[model samples]
Target: MLEREELKLYNRQIILPELGLAGQEKLKVARVLMIGAGGLGCPVLQYLVAAGVGHVGIVDADVIDISNLHRQILYSIADVGKPKAETAKQKLEWLNPFVELTAYEERLNTENAARLINLYDLIIDGSDNFTTRYLVNDTCVALNKPLVFGSIFKFEGQVSVFNYQDGPNYRDVFPEPPPENEVPNCDETGVIGVLPGIIGTYMANEAIKIICDIGETLSGKLFSMNALDNSMNVYKITKQRQAISAPVAANLAASPDREISMETLSNWLGETPDEICIIDVRETYEFDDYNIGGLNIPLYELQESVDIIPVDKKLVFICQTGQRSKIALQWTESHLKNEKYSLKNGIKHNL
Candidate 1:
């Protein structure tokens, strides 16, 4: 039974035919776990709480930083230096007292991901790293829980619902992670401030729809949007009968010569200055997080313009962690003959 104040708070959403009192009550009984308290997480958190999500768990290991202010809307200048999850909890509580918000100020790694996810009915991924994203997908798939996923690059964003009722998980669409150094995080590159807001809202919409069984869920489909052109595209994805293996373990267990690290690319940037032929694998938003100064080529874009990379100089690659940079090195070797490059691990590692 919704309290009088709760009904008043959610009156607008309750009025929608798709989401009347019954839907609202369904929402009140649902528990959503949002991974990452960054850009996408902010908007998703705000809207879900405002819509009366009964229990929302926020998981983020990072603290509020000055640079995050541009896109992570949940915090203020005063909130800087505080734990992101804790800060979001405060704001969400203010947004809807009817909802219960739990803040987990810890990073989600393989060891603890399953345990944490087991506590909630649904998981929303706003995490910027591929490792966490893959982990979320695998755990959800194994547990038979649903996941709402969102990601953003320079001008493009993606939204999808993975592992819903054993529907195609992310790996079903992207069976393998892009080669090392391929996809940079927002911290490594830079993202349009509004990109995450748009994608995150769409993610929130998907979560609500999944909870109430209202509209079409983005299951077994990838929704790609280009904010620059205001054009949208949907690609059908099929889950292969094959089990989705752990991409990281596959790459890590490879031979030494087969193994590589951005920081150990002696063949590429051993002696060259940081400026010449360096590629930033971090996403646009991530590049703005912290940078050692380099070219703004995101990981996803590098494959298309490999020739544009300077051959006269050695190329250095960077990303959120070393994973994407390693992929970039392999791609460069496989495609371009004149491109000389090495990986720089991540900005934090170099710093």
Candidate 2:
């Protein structure tokens, strides 16, 4: 279950009809293992944590370098010489306190690959090398875990979801790793800074979709995007299809049952005022000027006195823009699990 603060933090996304509370709940329960804390891993980690993935493990043994500050946006010059995994965890904590981040300041190797991958529901290959990529992929396949794969070159990048619901996998797409001599090093060949950012965001998006189990994911398809030419392509990856379990129903619409309008609130007050708890998440100044007679609890201070917000009645959070109210509902006691809602659009015009 998502914490009260998480509801407020992810209010913008939680209101999404496609994602709704159910999809956000799915994201909150997902445990993801990310291999590498380099170019692609940087953005992947940032967004995954921000999106409230329950637990994330970062695997990287490398330390920051002054040169890495460009594409690896998570690090700064002050972070140079610090281990990437630990540094990322430290930085990401400021991004989302609700996410549980673990740093393995060690490389993912054959010895620990299976053990580490076993702990996560999903795997993402953001490593810069083929050896690490192949290892992560094979381990994911063996463990029957879906993998979100991404790679960046100078101006081009590729993204794909492998072994998703028994669909195509990395080995099925690459067949064999390129010869070591033939592999181009980002250090030697040099990569454009913006290239990884574009690719990394795509990888993060794919991870979210995978976690929420929504949309036509890149499963059985490889997406290639080029920055220089401004081009994109989707290539079919051939694999013997396996029977896929029908995914849980997604894109649940925001039901009126979960949201309240001014008219509805007024009716509820007239009929059963004893059965509802209205919380005005606006400031004291705003509540003093006008309110529908609810406890005045500013959104910022909601976490402190959240326990006082009664849970037995139908809870309705209200604010001027409706955004804060959505966040207010999220800040309510998670353990209560009662009927909770946010005023739709706010009581500003209705008043």
Residue 72 in candidate 1, Cα distance off native in Å: 0.9
Query: 244-292 in candidate 2: lDDT tens per residue?
Result: 2211221111235667788888899899999988888776777898887
How far residue 259's Cα lies from its native spot in candidate 1, in Å, is: 21
Task: Encode model 1's per-residue lDDT on 143-211: one tens digit a residue.
Answer: 567899999998999999988765788877764457567878777778999999999999999999999
Cα lDDT computed for each candidate against the true fold = 0.78, 0.81
Candidate 1 regions with alpha-carbon error over 4 angstroms: 242-351
Residue 12 miss distance in model 2 (angstroms): 0.5
Q: Show the lowest summed lDDT stretch of 10 residues, model 1.
A: 245-254
TM-score on alpha carbons, each prediction: 0.69, 0.68
Question: How many residue pairs in model 2 have overlapping backbones?
Answer: 3
